[model samples]
Target: MSEQLAEERASARPIPGQVGGRAVMLIPRRDPGTDESMLPPDYQRIIAAVRQAAGPVMAREVGEGVGVDVSVKAKLEPLRGKLVRLVDRGWLQKLPDGRFTTRL
Candidate 1:
């Protein structure tokens, strides 16, 4: 791993029960810090669902767990987008095989 990745991994502290009764690893705020005010309600729900699963979950599985009607492609699309955004934001890690897990 690169030095930055190594440092990030090392610096992350485990936050128990931060999500869905599971332990989550969180990297301390680097500067401006976490802005919960910016997250939409749906996004928060998705995060909670991801935490409950507590592993590298596929998009469809996350949507199903979150109670989204997985039978409809349209409904799944937005949820998938939200999951991607969460991964981009460093709150999640996308595995090489396209699975997702909490960054911690």
Candidate 2:
């Protein structure tokens, strides 16, 4: 049982809360390097949509706003990852319900 593995396993444990009939857990991400700049245009667009919303914005909503069909999970998955990275970078806040909002 490596320390890192233990830590990850612990994090995977479910937390208490119900949103849309699903349990929600909020986990922060490890920070990436500071020198990293320049996000893709789509990432920027997603962030902008959340900021404009001025509240929690779901991934599906972001996809819809960006003219991408959220029904296609494959196309939506990459945007979700980018959203998580943006949250880690402090440009956005990821809510426990898998929604996001811009950081003030």
Candidate 3:
């Protein structure tokens, strides 16, 4: 092989997140709605529900408060994920009773 061609082939490196020779792009997870604000857009309903509640509220109530009558899991799953994110960010907390409340 030509020296230049050999060098070019040697310098070529595989991209990350690839498995089994498939191109899988891996991105760090982040809340898209939290770009410029403390609260993410996706969790606005959740926050509203918690804020409107008399006290710390259950996840079910928050899911219902999102206007979801059925498929509560659909609502709760993303809400739960966002809540975890918020908690990690120090803006919310999960109570011992599996409820949520805002820190600020």
Q: Give the alpha carbon lDDT tens digit for every residue of 1-104 in model 3.
A: 67776565445432357679987533223332222123334455667777788888776777777775536567567667766665676556788887888775
Count of residue pairs whose backbone atoms collide, per candidate: 0, 0, 0
- Candidate 1: 10-residue stretch with minimal lDDT: 27-36
lDDT of each: 0.69, 0.68, 0.61
Indicate the worst ten consecutive residues by lDDT in candidate 3.
27-36
| Top candidate when judged by TM-score against the true structure | 1
lDDT of 1 by residue, 1-104 (tens): 67777666555543434778777544233223443333556666777777788677888888888899999999988888777777776666788987777765
Instruction: Please identify model 2 stretches exceeding 4 Å from their true place.
Output: 1-38
Considering TM-score, which of the candidate structures 1 and 3 is the better prediction for this target?
Answer: 1
Question: Candidate 2: what lDDT?
Answer: 0.68
lDDT of 2 by residue, 11-99 (tens): 55324577899974443333442211244456667767776775698888888888888999998987788788778867788888888
Q: Give the C-alpha miss distance for residue 2 in model 2, angstroms.
A: 44
RMSD of each candidate relative to the true structure? 11.4, 11.0, 12.5
